[model samples]
Target: MKQKVAVLGAGSWGTALAKTLVENGHDVMIWGNHEKQIDEINEHHTNTHYLPDVKLPEALKGTLDLAACIADADAVLFVVPTKATREVAAKFAAVCQNKPVVIHASKGLEKDTHKRISVVLAEEIPADKRQDIVVLSGPSHAEEVAVRDVTTITAASENLASAEYVQSLFSNEYFRIYTNQDVIGVETGAALKNIIALGAGALHGLGFGDNAKAAIMTRGLAEISRLGVAMGADPLTFIGLSGVGDLIVTCTSVHSRNWRAGDLLGKGHKLDGILENMGMIVEGVSTTRAAYELAQEMGIEMPITQAIYDVLYNDVDVDDAIRAIMLRDYKSEQEFTFN
Candidate 1:
């Protein structure tokens, strides 16, 4: 029952997933655009650039050639950043044949356009060739996942049978995968949570305790849910794995790039300086732009998201954004729970 699998992007999440597939006894190949990453994975069984500390499984073959990586694979996991999705997927469109079920581990809505990762997938990958598109998301940190830290994620597809199939492929003792059919909800929940996480990180960096962080996490989720509902997603899906569960993990984890970046930014360092030092994609930064705009279109009140947007994109001082969030018009804590 071994199926061929390909994982594009050799970043922490991508490498961990490729390694997981290999451990699951599947034929897994990883595609990296950088030749050095390919060499590191092939020769040293490691991805020195992204997830340098962890060792990758030997079964996870790495290659620069897209055709070789996608060769007859039953599943293809796209783990590239949100900004790169369209361009990389365009190139993937040419070489990927017999459209396999795609799994997107990267989370973000495209800047300005507000297109979710799956939307980009559908646009780039021809419909006739597509089998099923799936989203895998939850409270997962690549650092914890690499060390096998009891990670649980939801594997969701529009088709129940396909979702179960994808779930069965990854569920194990260390890793547990659930199934959901709310594709839009799952994707939105996953993407929007990163913004909340960034806000939480800033709270932490500003010497705010768990109380303030918890408040942001709670209200942040409300904003995300409101926006998702406005955008055609089921409300209850926000309560599930893809929503609250993912939000908690990302906001609290030290391993979160968005959180870490926001933490540094909160400490009064310039955005350019922080990013220059980290050399990683803080999805929340760009996702904030998308979320901020999407909320305006939907007319939902998302103070936390708007605050983060100002800090990242509007050149507003981090301390000022924090003050704005604190001074927002006060309302009942359960304003959304009118029942």
Candidate 2:
């Protein structure tokens, strides 16, 4: 079914998704704050700043007017950064009238509240203005997806129908979508994996070998699964696309902002300097702090997250943090046996 989809970000992911929707025969409009970028997208059909060298579909449009972009849209997809989510959602709620199946592709927990993006959306958007929230997440990178590379992701929602609805909108020859009912697991895995990606990049920058990288990734999954299960997520979801799949790609890919940020940090660069140089939002940097706080508050043992948090927040050296992690009391490799 053809639908008018409003994409609430002009970043690489937003433009890529908007392009996909347009190609899929849906009416898509991307809302961006920058007039220059919006004009570029509308007039030139390109978003060079984010997805350089990639040409967007001419059918896809961009608008500076948020209200105009979302007006009469069948669905609203929020792809903005975590910090900007609430502000954008509130604005959408104020202007939106009809109920749209709200979808978010952004991954990260709220800084202080430690809430998932879906939870943040639910809080800011009034029930009368929106339907069930769906989270689209996996190993898909904007650069790859923009080029029509084969990619698969999970569209997760507690409302199964909504998840399937989202899956229909995004599934195509190059982009495939799977529906999952475990919104909590999907969202948490999506957010927490960025933290591990940071550690992975740090390991790389610190001159560690493949063995160290493998250890961080494997142990990182354990930490993610532990906290995720404690927070009421399904244990099996950890092995699915949003968990291991997302973790592997984010940790290993050069396209990951979190990994790049962590690489700089591992090289002994200051957080502020690294962020300023990156010219993009590194979700892991903020996620490390949130996860650290959440783990401490919940009494969950997430040592890797704590180590990354210390390096980012407490001015602890990356080497010292790594050493501390390695020197921690050893225990059974498997915390619990699977039947």
Measured by TM-score, the strongest candidate is: 2
- Model 2 is weakest, by summed lDDT over 10 consecutive residues, at 330-339
Candidate 1, lDDT over the whole model: 0.86
Clashing residue pairs in all predictions, respectively, total: 0, 0
Q: lDDT per residue, candidate 1, 198-280, as tens digits?
A: 88988888999989987888888888888888788999999998999999989998889888988887787788888788877
- Residue 75 lDDT (model 2): 96
lDDT of each: 0.86, 0.92
Q: lDDT score, residue 281, model 2?
A: 91
| C-alpha lDDT (0 to 100) for residue 242 of candidate 2 | 97
Score every model by TM-score.
0.96, 0.98
Write model 2 residue lDDT over 170-198, tens digit each, in one string.
88999999999998999999999999999
CA RMSD per model (angstroms): 1.6, 1.4
- Displacement of residue 262 (Cα, Å) in model 2 is 1.2
